[model samples]
Target: MSSAGGPAIGTITTEVPARLDRLPWSRWHWMIVVGLGTVWILDGLEVTVVGNIASRLSESGSGLPISDSQVTGLGAALYVAGACSGALVFGWLTDRFGRKKLFLITLAVYLASTAMTALSFSAWWFFLFRFLTGFGIGGEYAAINSAIDELIPSKYRGRVDLIINGSYWLGAMGGALLSVLALDTGIFPENIGWRLTFALGVVLGLVILLVRRHVPESPRWMFIHGQSDGANAIVEGAEKEIEEETGAPLPKAGRAITIEQRRSISFVEIGRTLFRAYPKRATLGFSLFIGQAFLYNAITFGFSSILVKFFGVSSGTTGYFFAVIAFGNFLGPLLLGRLFDTVGRKKMISGTYILSGLLLFVTAWLFDQGWLNATTMTVCWCVVLFFASAGASSAYLTVSEIFPMETRAMAIALFYALGTAAGGISGPLIFSGLTSSGVVSDAVVAFCIGAALMVAAGVVAVLFAVDAEGKSLEDIARPLSQRTKPTGRPAGPPSAPAV
Candidate 1:
């Protein structure tokens, strides 16, 4: 061929940007976030508010009417029971059905259950409502996290999810505010505080419905599961809109990956894929899942109780203290986001693990020396929570990113289910058991253990985990990265998928 005016035989251009598979934060992102946030907030409230409410319930001779010890024991029991159910049920449903549909159904159950509990005539009713709410919460935790992980650009995935999840702190603060205000009025803490607080969940659920209406079924998932038409439509619509606004050529489409007709894959196949196809990622997911569960449950469930019992803070004061602590939680993820993208994934997460551990060690020392009494304790806890939020958020984001759309829900659920069920149950079980058995002074011990575990997990992650920040999802989830090792991993698609 002539060099100057002649046509080349094999010249090609990619119309799609590398970032297409990953979506930027837009109005769609916000709408879906609100949907996910509502579910997450309720989950946070359900776990955290129990400590404050247990005291209220016990004093009023309502629902179990147990002593402080009994309240802790039963609440822990109920929570674990529900969480176990969640890990099993919701994760399965999320993968088997559509994320968008399951989103609606789970919220309805949460709203109805919480509303019923608010008007309960006795403790039995309250207990039942809590169990049901717990169930809804369990399912939602798995679904929303998986959905958002698949919905966004791999590069921006961590920040999008972190911001979405950071709203959980806002939810906790709301609960704390309500707890303090009610207790101060001498109305809620006396007999009906827990009831009113739970009703707030119903309001949250209603709001979720409005927001979720805007969230489409996960496009990545649709493509993976043979919903090609649905997947193409979601991507094409977004592309047309982007082109109109930016005046750019349409995004490039990758080599065709036809959605084959076949019987639905079995759960065992998903499990085998996790364990065999990508064992290291599976292990990473497991460690992060369990470690975070330990960290979060310890803080959320045990903090209020320690405030009331050791510090002698009034219920209102405790609420304010908890709210301040959560403010740190809300900020932690945002701060981490800036570094998470620039620094490689391992560097950022490994740092979070070490820093979080050190912070908690300092937090424990402050609490032990009585240096953190009341106001100081709240301040100290906030600092600790900030670091903890960073580690926890990174863990969740990584888990979501490490798996593919075909098995992402199951992969996420497997770790989350095992870790959350164990850690969620363990936090309350340990605190209540120690309190009842006189084995320990307070809940601070849980933080100490959590920090140590995080350090260990961080070390493991750095040693084995691959850096995934800024990579494509298809590339990130490819088994050959490790399974077919020694042939250095390749970078980028010749053409990118229309995200």
Candidate 2:
């Protein structure tokens, strides 16, 4: 292959996919997980800190003159908007260029923007950087999810994807506890405490950048883009390393596939693939994303205000309650993730979404009756999120795997941007209005809205969820580049119309 402006383009028969899917679990795989998956922690930290610090930032001496409602409502909406925009631009670039390059570039963008946020002198300055931070994170979603799904073994893919996506809550837990300390005037001055939280996010991002440097480009991507030699070398290296680690030779790989290699897929092809070639899967992707995005945005962005206004909890003490629910969120995916593989994707995904939604409906009724304190409310959220979190993480898993190889990143970007825009942008705005009003009826309305969406998404899952567990991605959705046979048949049409 020539090292020029782009990868050399030509037809190539390769077994890169089968080789990758057959490897045993080893330390090398763990390295990839740690490097790629840890970014969600930073995202969780960014979101949770902003929510938890809204009240602090609105105080008399906090330097920025933002109000609580603006921070939670307008600021949160802008962040989601930035994320939606970033996902589209970067998702296309990731598919065209490569996963490693885009992931690294996106992370650097996040680090710089977050660092600037720490030095903001006004509310507009704070809001601008928040949007930029979301932009970087949004790109990470497209690049990272496609890369991880492409790289992980098929047997471990379902559970691993769930746990990695769910790791966001671990960062949420940290941010919640960190906010308690930062908001305390006894430890940090009012003006400096919130700024320190943003600064710390930058620091953690820098550490992750160092580790992410070593993660490889997806071998699946390389061969399809006309770098078959590079793809073969990577698979061979992995096989050697795994064999040494396990003290045994590996099994023979499955059949090779013939691919008419290309530089990139077009937006028109991507749209047809999503809407025409696989409409049912597209519906599943949108439903799962919209449901999770709205539910998470409503609760995550508005929970602090709900505690302070409705239950009379102190601003500084709200983090303790938030932390309990964040733990529940993380535990949900970690504990139940394996079940997605064991019991199967269709059953597990639908079950979690429906169960969580019903639980939230009950919690909303109790809150409407004024029969709960801050502690009881937090407990209710903990139980509701225990299932919702797993269901939410699976949304990412579903989008990444159900699409063709060339369109994986863009597919993830489209579903995330459109679905999140529908739910995420409006969720915080509505919840912020309701919770800030301090009216029990208004808050209950917000809860019911979120609960209803989850139930609706669960019903969609029952109708459309793919049975993707333990199946090779090629089997689920053939790459656009793949040919019908080695010699007998002509290469299939180079578009989704052929599918």
Candidate 3:
């Protein structure tokens, strides 16, 4: 094996990806899940806490002079803007650098910015750090998703990815409950509670950073970047460790692939690979992302307002309702994720999206008719989101896997930024305006729009979703650095199967 800093520029053939995919589930895989996947939970906690605390922050003696509208509207917008900007910048960097390096740096950024947010004494300071905090979390989406897809076995990839993405709701659940306690006047003073919430995020981030340190970089990344010896060492070590842990002989790895290794891929090549080389896939990615983004933003941004205004549910108790809905979101992926792997991606992705959209249409009709109360409305959202969350989580999985390995991180970043922008910006603006209008019909229109978009995306899924369940990443989309075998044509899309 070569040294860690050995040459990173040559063609080499290796079965690193095959070896990784063929391994039996083991303790080491769990370590990767805990180390890498937990970041989503932190993100959920960050976004949720800010939202729940917005009203408190706008109050007298809360220390900041920000209004409720400023905290919820402008601050939220800046945070999302920061996240989109960060994803694009760090995503490109993650593709350029190794996953381990970028993931660590992104997490550090989250910790530092969030920690500073806890100390903010002014509105500008608070808003600036919120954006920076989002910046760090945005980078995590690209780096972590790429690493997780590359590292996880193909058989378990669909469920694992969905669950990891879905874990954001788990953090949302935590944040919802945490805010209830944080905002309690008996437990904490108004000014102190909000600051402590941000501090807790920093504490959680620090722990995640510690666990993440032990996780290794993607070996597939190493081999393609001309670190073949290091790649082989890592794979071989994993194979040996899994065998010992599982107490069984391991299966032989599948076929080896040759590559024309390089240190980096240019944005021009990345663009061509996504648009020109795989235009259908680019469309699929956009459809899935936009659909899910709008629906989530519509419901989440308007959820509390709807309860308070239409149903007369008190603002103080909205957290309890949100926690229930968040739990439903997490459960969707946990219960339905295995089906995506077993039933196949096309059928499952489309089914979930379509099902959720149909359910939302019914909910909208019921809301417009004034036949539902707060409890029933919450139940309706819980049901609708049960399917929507699973479909939404699959969007990330689809984009990450369908692109070439060289563009994996950037693809995840681009789709995320686009989806988040579309949904995060438009969903909130449209839904908030509708729900706050004190007209039930207006809010119903917003819900219908979200539902219609979701249904349309599902229709697209039925037409274009890739049948990627249990397939090798190399088989789904061949790496750009890969070399064709003697007498074989140059690499294109995998001819194995289609949706």
TM-score of each: 0.86, 0.96, 0.94
Task: Give model 2's TM-score versus the native structure.
Answer: 0.96
Model 1 lDDT tens row, 1-499: 1134422212122212233553444565566677676676776676657766656656644444556654565655576567568656877888777688777787887888788877876556666777787777767767788788766766677677776777778778777777776555455435555667777778877877887888888765554444545655776677666666666674444323222222245788787887887888877777776777777775566666676777776655677788788778989887877667777778877777777778777877766676767788778767777877877877767777787556666666677777776676676677665444433335557668877877777787787676877766666774211222112223223542222
In the range 244-294, model 2's lDDT, one tens digit per residue, is 999999987745678878888889999999999999999999999999999
Runs with alpha carbons beyond 4 Å of true place in candidate 1? 1-19, 22-24, 61-64, 186-189, 245-263, 435-444, 479-499
Question: Which regions in candidate 3 have their CA more than 4 angstroms from the true location?
Answer: 1-6, 485-499
lDDT (10s digit) by residue, model 3, range 360-471: 9999999888899988988999999999999999999999999999999999999889988987767776776777788999989989998998999999999999999999
RMSD of 2: 3.5
Better of 2 and 3 by lDDT: 2
Task: Give the Cα-based TM-score of candidate 1 against the true structure.
Answer: 0.86
Candidate number of the best lDDT: 2
Least well predicted 10-residue stretch by lDDT in candidate 2: 490-499
Clashing pairs for predicted structure model 3, backbone only: none
Q: Which ten residues in a row have the lowest lDDT in candidate 3?
A: 490-499
